[model samples]
Target: MREISFSVQALTAGYGNIPVVRDVTFTLPKGTILTLIGPNGAGKSTILRTISGQLSVLSGTVMICGKALSGLSPAALAREMSLLLTDRVRPEMMTCFEVAAMGRYPYTGRFGRLTAGDRQIVRSALARVHADDLAEQDFLAVSDGQRQRVLLARALAQEPKILILDEPTSYLDIRQKIELLSILLEEARERQLTIVMSLHEIDLAEKVSDLVMGIRDSCVFCSGTPEEIFAGDTIRHLYGIQEGTFLTRTGSIELPRTRGNSRIFVVGGAGFGLPFYRALTRKRIPFSAGILFENDLEYGTALSLAVRVHSVPAFARTMETAFGEAEKDLLACQAVLDAGTRIGETNAANARLLASARSAGIPVWRTIHEQD
Candidate 1:
């Protein structure tokens, strides 16, 4: 069997004799990433704190490298793990390099001064996170994104087997978030690092995690591979989503579609329809989409944004034989958008829609917009 780099068995974590999270059990092999996801106050951070040895575990055991976390000496554990939490740190005018070198505390001498080798490690860690340029600058002077990278470099400087992070993407822009996660993923693959972290971005979590755990009501609601855990109504139920819905295809949340006359009929397929759907939504235009194969990339978006979606089984030649509803929808709309979907053997019916619109004197445009 592959060696388990980290494992938790029935871990219950909280403060002052009260349990905030309980019965959470999971194991991660080397180079694996595990992410915790839940609504706010769902105890994700609490669990991370306990396992990282910041907060005491109320019950159960956390094992690092086949030995219990409690049994390992502080220096031994420090050598095996690096942790980054969300708690604010106000470094008093410290240089970024000095901040990163703190990670070498486990190896530093009794005087707590960094040696030449330690300084070299710190410099390399800063460079690894692309923040070596900021090494001489005041930690407080950099942007939030740069500070976040520096902090990650501090964690990397530990050169540990496992890493623990809480909401690592906070205070980062969309592009920065992508870069950080991409770097972490590459580091995991290259270094055989075990990772545990919490993420509010379900889309990124789905894309990045080797395993996923959903927390709710003080316990684990479900745990599995991203495929198994994100199926059906799992995410919707996990976060008690009411105002919006979790979309499995996009791995994101979408608000309810506008309610009004579906005055526009869209002929969309493949991925051509996605932006059009969102554009219509942004304009608050009520629209219906149809004739999409169930497996098309935009079908899920259509279902979320369109009032009445006319669909058929994937890859079926239903366009030739079962064009009743689409024809009916075409007649009721004020305009038709082609979405410029390609004509093919399976979806030749869309051409018929365009032809029918022109014949009926209903305006058909390759694109659409709300009149200003």
Candidate 2:
């Protein structure tokens, strides 16, 4: 088994003698990636600040490598852990290189001068984050995305055993978010670095976390593997999400289906119906979709956005009874939409539905844009 990196026991933490988070606890092994998730003001940042030794622990204990958090000196703590928080660092006269090199201060001598070895590590860190080009530029003048990468580089240059981040992906674009998280994963895998962070992007959190802890009501509400935490309305309840539901299979979110009048019958399956469903939802056009296999890629979205979905077991044949029901619904609808689902030998019933719609003089739209 890997060594335990950090342990929190019955910790009550906040600023200035008041506790914002109470009785939080977890143990992470070396190389473990743990994510804290919840709605805003759930004390995730407070918990992170306390464990990282930036804020005082109101009660209980925090241990890093078997050493008490309060017992470790500033230099000792810096050597053991690094942070990239929402807080901005504006170094007036420092270049990005100098700001990044500050991460080596834990190892620097009394005068805080960097040797050739330290400079090399700093450069390598900048390159790892693809910010080497900005090394000569002033830290304060870079864009937020570039600044985020530089801060990450600084944290990496620290080469600490544990990293604490709060909303580390803030101000990052989609591509930057992917690259930064991928780099963190690589670091954790190759260097045995333990990570504890809070992310608003639960989808990315679900993908990257080894252990997920849900923080709410000023305490640790749920802590388990990502599978356990993300399974079945747990996140919905965790965040009190009323607008849309969380999709477990794909780790995505979908807006609620409209219940207004003028329903449209849709024939969709095999991932072909996603855009049509979203477009309908965006237009506030209520729809009933059907004939999807339970394992279809868009099944979750269909479930969330469709007023009533007709589905069959994955790999099972579409029976005549289902076809009869769908045809009835189709004829009763104002129109039918064909999401361009292929009519294979198994799902050829959908083709009959389309034919039935045309027979009844109901509009058979080959594309949703026809109605648009």
Candidate 3:
């Protein structure tokens, strides 16, 4: 087993005498990533702040490398952990390189000037985050995403054993989000750095985290492996998501299913039906969908959008009974949509449904954009 890098024991943290999150306990093994997730105002940030020593712990303890946080000097703590906080930073007249170079303060001499090796480390950190282009740009002038990357580069320059981030991806686009997290993943693996961060993107968190901690109702709601935390209705209930469905397998969310009787029938499979289902849902057109295997990529979206759905076991041949039910639904509808599912032995029922729709004089559409 890997050495434990950080541990939180029955911690309660917040401002002043009040507690925002209580009884949060977890341990981070070397090179592991733990993510905190919850709805807004659930104290995810508070937990991070407390652990990073930016805020006082109202109760309990935080230990880094078996040493209590309270016992460590500021410089020692800085050497052990680095943080990228959500707090806005505006360094006047400083370039991005200067901002990032500040992270080496713990190792700098009294004069605090960067040595040649320190400068190289700063450059390497910027390159690691793909922010080398922004090095010459004025720190205050960069976009939020660029600033975030620079801040992360700064934290990396600290070369701490642990990294704590608060909503690090908040300002990042999808591509930047993936790139930044990928860098963190690589660093954790190669450097054996422990990572603790709070994220609003539960889907991304699920993908990157080894352990997931859910904060809710001023306490640690739950903590476990991603497989344990993301299973079933855990995510849905954690976020109090009543308006839509959360698909655990794909970590994708779908809007609430359209209510009332379905007027249109959609024949889709092999992950081709997702866009059509979403388009119909946006148009507020309640539709029925059929002949999807439980393992289909679009199955979750179909369940959330379609008023009714016909599905068979994953990897199993489409049952005749399911096809018959789908055919009946198709015949009752005035129109049918063929989502361009590939015709194969396993999904041959979809082809039959399309043919049946044509025979019944129900207009069959190859795409959602087709004219009536």
Q: Predict model 3's lDDT versus the native.
A: 0.89
Q: After superposing candidate 1 on the true structure, give the runs of residues whose Cα lies further than 4 Å from its correct spot.
A: 368-372
Q: Model 3, 213-252: lDDT tens per residue?
A: 9988898778899999999898888988898899998888
Query: Which parts of model 2 are misplaced by more than 4 Å?
Result: 368-372
At residue 336, give the lDDT of candidate 2. Answer: 88
How would the candidate models be sorted by lDDT, starting from the highest? 3, 2, 1
Q: Which residue pairs show collisions in model 1?
A: none
- Report the lDDT tens digits of candidate 2 across residue range 27-97: 99999999999989999999999999899999999999999999999999999999998987887988999
lDDT of each: 0.89, 0.89, 0.89
lDDT for residue 68 in candidate 1, whole number 0-100: 92
Better of 1 and 3 by TM-score: 3
lDDT of 3 at 108: 96
TM-score per candidate: 0.93, 0.96, 0.94
TM-score top scorer = 2
Q: Number of backbone collisions per candidate, in order?
A: 0, 0, 0
Candidate 3 error regions (>4 Å): 368-372
